[model samples]
Target: MQTVNLGIVAHVDAGKTSLTERLLHATGVIDRLGSVDAGTTQTDTGEIERRRGITIRSAVVSFTVRDRQVNLLDTPGHSDFVAEVERALGVLDAAVLVLSAVEGVQPHSRRIMRVLRSLGLPTLIFVNKIDRAGARVDELVADVRRLLTPTVVPLGTVRAPGTPGASYRPHPRGYDQRLAEVLAEHDDDVLAALVDDLPLDGDRVDEALRAQVAAGQVHPLLFGSALSGAGVPELLDAVAALLPPSPPAESDPRARVFAIERDPSGERVAYLRAYGGQFRTRERVTAYRREPDGRTTATRGRITRLDVVGAATDRAALTAGHIARVVGLTGVRLGDQLGSPAGLDGRSHFPAPTLEAVVRPREASRTLALHAALLDIADTDPFLRTRVAPDGGTSVLLYGEVQREVLSSTLVETYGIEAEFGPGRLMHVERPTGTGTAVEIIGHGFFGTVGFRVEPGDGVDYRREVELGSLPLSFHTAIEEAARAALDQGCHGWPVTDIRITLTHSGYWSPITTAGHFRDLAPYVLMQALAEAGTRVFEPCRRFDVEVPADRLGPVTSYLSRLGARLDGTAAVPAGWRIAGVLPARLELEAQRRLPDLSSGEGLWSSTPGGDRPVSGEPPRRARTDGNPFDRVAYLRFLAQPPSRPVAVRDAGPERGHRSPR
Candidate 1:
């Protein structure tokens, strides 16, 4: 049987879980439909997700549709869970974007659609909850077109009768003309025949619609009321007929490591998608690592296991399909592309993290345990990187607050370590503001002299690149590392950004200084270079959208102003007014509390990292005068100019931590 790997994506509370339950029931994978409110949904099996009644992570389920094995990935709808959705899309052959017939297209739905388009995946739209009163199929379709592309057209509609807030029967084919119009648009020949008043065959039109959908030129919309299983069988038929089997790309022999997983047994498994060529068990594959010294090392590991979708009755693995837990490859690392003789370079899709914070165990004894646990988690998700800070802090790069929370929880639960997360701070970059010259004299009369300039560059905004040449490769690497170390902690104790450095020219002795000596001396010279160029701190700003009843708009706006949030505008939504704004991330927690009180429990809000903006005016002075530890000169000359130690954090007086909720 053929195999297909597909995913269902939608906004939060848009009936994704309901649709998933109905699909499972229709395919006979489950004897009964699970309820999301009851927290019995198969995909939302995580304890936290079940408790919260929302999907926190993506789940994969396997089932059969019309004799073809299918693997379905259900992704979270909340923006905070977008990382899971992004990762799931990488391995999917197709995607089903779910929309509520009443809510129409939401901001997150449009965002997910845009991501799918960028990934070039074949997409299908399912307008769910049609049986709900006030569900307008035509209006929602138009909204989808306005928000996303115009490729989607509804195939049919489901009708049920009731007032707004009441349930109705799942009636089929109540409106056939709309379905005919959509089907006719699938092909020019069909439209011509329709215009000529010629009869159209249902089977031929179905074939044409399937062809258009497979080609990605059209997105077929199917209506279904998952609550009552209305139009579910027709939706299943559409999925089986329109979605093509995973194409054979195993001939190319190169596999890209798109994801990594760790089984319950504590083994690391690299999830590979073979863009080309077949992989067999026990074959020796080469691995490459780009080191800090600008050199690449080649290693080898034997493939211990091989599996494919549709290989088992459970649909474990198949060609061009999703597979998991195929363990036994010992030496493979995350993002390593495996091939027969030559290996492929697997770089991450997003930029390396720019923000970092210290995560320390509540008890000092658990430091190593916490470090080991974080390392293991980092292997599965490469975006969150960890390194030891210069001040003996465990520095971790995070995507955002949600990721930070997950990491903290994992550290606590997996390793029995209680971790305290420090404040989120900006990760900065360093560059030369102008042309300058420096000389490095090392042991045994070895001298390496160079002219350098730091300037700004693109790619990762607010980062500076050091462009240098004329020095030996070893010396060049040493210089780069030295520059990075210098910028590791910026003047304001934040990482630098949007700067570039150029080693315009250099002179060096061949045997006088080895790479090691240069590496050691580079940090001191880079510090001087950084001092020559002024440094500044940049803070992160978040774009937020808050929804509240119209009556509470005035209070919502007032609260936003008090929190230093700039109101972009307000739009009328079905539930309330959507107040759009940009606010500093540090104030987010307080803002969340204020909004609920302002709207009296009737307000909702969501925010994402919109990128960084300058912290307006000069930042407030630090309460203490303890200088930053990252400064080399300050530490080297501590005797001449002593720095203050950190003050003890004392418990507040009786009156503190006792504020009443307003």
Candidate 2:
């Protein structure tokens, strides 16, 4: 049977979930259709998600379309959960991008399209909710062509759009001049044939259209109302007819872990999208992960249990193009490559969280429990980063308030602990302004000497001037790992980025030199170098798009200006004034909150992540989690303290709580 891993993606409230429900019902996977408003959707089974009427986690379900097996992954639509979407993107064979007829092309819609195009994933556009009030089928289609790609060919037309009588009629499957014209833009043969007025073969045109769609160069647009079940069958037919299937599995086994969840008994269950070979029950697999230094680490684990999609038994083999729920790979994490990393790129598809909020327990006594729960959540969603302060206060990195709210609710519901979150703030990073070097020798009760030279560069580049054969690989790995972890909190307490660090010196007593010694001393030496280099702090920024009544443009622009927005461009639109600019991420929420009032509730505001810039004024400070290594006296004492003593080093990266090797 053929297989395709499909994803349904869209902006929030664009009816993605509703469409999922419609597809499931149409496929006879479920007898009764679930409603998003009532919180009864199959994919949205969490209590909190159902109550909120949104998808917090990506859900997977399998159904057959004739001889093809379709594993449909319904992903979160809200921007707060875009990391979920990012994870899903890596495992997909193709995607269905949903858009609302009334809302037309939204900011997130454009964002999703950009990612899909970048990945070259074949996509089909579903313009949903055609039977709703204010639906503009023609205008929305035109806008999709203008704002999105002009390579889209409408598969059908909607009759009586924006009314109860709305219906879809697919264009006849024949030689179409419009389809040929769209294809001609990319195909010289088609263009020549059209120009020469030669006979066009429908079979040839169909084959060319299929090839282009599979290449992601052309998109097909279909109009439907998911709520009314119109045009759904056509969409389903397109999935089987137009989109390509996953390639056959290779003899070598490989799978990418995309989603993770805990079973009812709290055992970790990872959803794997297999690319080659097969995963069997009780089989051992090696998991490979790429580190910050661009080095790959490997660990082995046995699969205690396995559940293959569309299989009749739990022990069935999970082959390529299928998804499975596997347990007992305790060290396996989201993005881990099982068996091999051959076909997967370890780069992140989405931007990191630019906002963070301090999470505090209401009773103050459950701080430890709150922190533990948060760590578990972070393990599931790697982008939802958690930090611990010296005072035991915990903060979580986030994309926006929705993530914070969901976190708060999850803490209360899952862990039975009430928590409060502080106001969100911009997450800043530091970069070294100059070059500086520091070295710690073996005489100070430690058996090793490690040196690092810090300089500005792109990403966390680590190199070595010392000979590779000078020390054991274990010791070298320890130094590289410690160096990367130290940069997690730089001189100003922000994660230092875009810097190059080179190991310039290394010396240790042969028998007495333990990897732990290098690990312990590397941070102190690196921090000293960063301080001498004088790091600069940079704050995140966002590009904003605003539309308001022509009469309210002055007030809206004035308010935005007061909030420190740099208006890069402006134009007059039929609805109002369209403004584009860059705004500090710290003030984005405030600007969004006040836009409606400024425009008398007729304003439309949207923003996308823009690269950060250095702060112009005095830089803000964050609570230091790493021992104050810049202060020689305090750091020496910190290192001298006994292992049993309570200390401020609660923010250890990756290896947190593990005793240092002696």
Candidate 3:
């Protein structure tokens, strides 16, 4: 059977999870339908998700549609969980984007569509909730074309929409002139037939539609009510007929692990999607990960357990084009390409979280437990970076307020920890302002010596002026890792970014020097160099879009202006005026909360990460999570004591919050 990895994606509460349950039932994968409200959905098995009726993780479930074995990925709809959607995108062959007919095209809806188009994934737009009251199927198609892509072709129409009996009617063969025109935009045969006023062949049109859909040049739009099962059968048929199947698997073993979850026994389970070759249980496999230095590193691990999706038995082997739950790969992480680096880059698809808040344990006695729990949670969602200070203060990066709430609840429900969150703040970074160099000679306090020259660059560029083989690979790696870690806290205590550092000199006492010696010496020397170079702090900013009644534009703009937003342009949209601009991420929450009131609840607002800019005044400082490397006495004192467990290292390398080996 052909395999299809189809992702179900949408804005929050668009019935995406509902659609998954419906699909499973329609394909006889399940005996009864599971409701999101009742919290009985197959994919949303987490306690918090069931209680909150939300999807926090992207879930994979398998079912069959005729001869096709479909591995359906139900992704989180809330914008806070876009990271989950991004990971899912890396593994999917195609996608089914669900939109609510009642809500029409939402801001997140447009954002996801843009990402889909950018990735060139063959998509099937399913306009759902047609049976809900106030649903407008026909108008939504127009809205989709206007707000989303203009190349979408409506595959069918809705009958008795906005009612309980709402149903779908597939278009009759050769009846859609728009379909011909859409195809003709790229098809020479169709264009010739249309230009010459020649009769178009129905068979030709049907064939062209399938080919275009598979090529990601066109999207097939379908109407359905996942709640009532209206038009669901037709949607399933369209999925089988329209979307492309998995490409032929190559002979080389290539796969990517898109997600990681802990099983009931607390063992880590990695969701691996194989694109080629095969690996059996007990087989040793090499996982490949691209490092920050543009180099790929390989780690070998034996697969102790493997269960293929849709297999009747616990499949001992994973083949190409199939997803499997594999355990005992200690070195594997989400988005790690196994066997070969043949998949998409696992580096962040979206910008890092712009907002951060300090999390204080309500009872000071529980601080250590809270920190440990947060680190454990970060293992599953790497984007939820947790930072810890020497003073025991802890903070977490956030996407938005909704994610904040979910995380707070998760801590209480899962870890039984009560915590208070400080007001959100923009995550700022520092960049080197000039060139400076420093050197630490051997025997000053340790057996290793290191020197580094620091200056501005495109990103965290680590180079070596010293010869490659002058020291052992492990020692070199240790120095590089420590240099990057030291930059986590710059002169102003914010993480340093957009900087270049070259190791100018290195020395180690032949028998006495260890990797730890270089690790300890590298940070001290690098920070001193950074202090000499000086740095500038930049605050995160966001690109925003607002639509409100023209009459409300003045107040909206005024409110935005007060938030220090820089307006780029204002144009008249169908229902209102559209204003676009860049706003400080720190003020985004206030703007999001006030826009509805300013427009009498009709204002629509959306924003995306717009990079960062230098602060206008004295730069703000974050508490240093790394030992204060700039203070030589304090840092050496810190190194003398037993090292405390590090908090989850976000955007940092190798050591990613795991406890060091004894």
Q: Where's the lowest-lDDT run of ten residues in candidate 3?
A: 653-662
- Which tens-of-lDDT digit does each residue in 1-662 have in candidate 2? 78889999999999999999999899989999999889989899888889999998999998878778899999999999998999999999999999999988999998899899999999999999999989988888787896678898998899999998899999988878889999988788888999999877978788888899999999999999889899999999999999999977877999999999888898999999888888899899999987645678899999999998764223478788889999999988788899987855558778899777888899988988998999989878879888775666788899888888898898998899999888877789999999988887777656898888999998988999999988899999899898898887886678999999999999889898899988888888888777768789899999888999999999999989988999998988778889999988888879989988999999998888887889988777776666666665556677777643424743432222222222
Off by over 4 Å in 3: 291-295, 312-314, 360-366, 412-420, 593-601, 645-662
Scored against the true structure, residue 358 in model 1 reaches a CA lDDT of 82
Point to the candidate with the largest lDDT.
Answer: 2
Instruction: Score candidate 1 by lDDT.
Output: 0.63
TM-score of each: 0.73, 0.92, 0.92
So what's the TM-score on candidate 2? 0.92
Candidate number with the higher TM-score (1 or 3): 3
Q: List per-candidate RMSD values in Å.
A: 8.4, 4.2, 4.8
Candidate 1 on 1-662: residue-level lDDT in tens?
Answer: 67777889999888988889999898888998888888999888755567668886677677788867777878888765565675677667888998888887787887788777776677888877776776876677776775687767666655552223323222242324444466566577777777897766667666776776776767877777788777678777777888877777665455645455555666766666555545667667775653322235567787777655333433232234445444666666554556632443232333345557788888877777777777877766555667654343467887567667766776665667788888866554333334333444333223555444544543212222334445666677676666655455444444555556555444566667566555545544544444456554556677888889989999889989988988899888777788988988778778998777899899887665556656667542211111222233333343234222222112221122121111
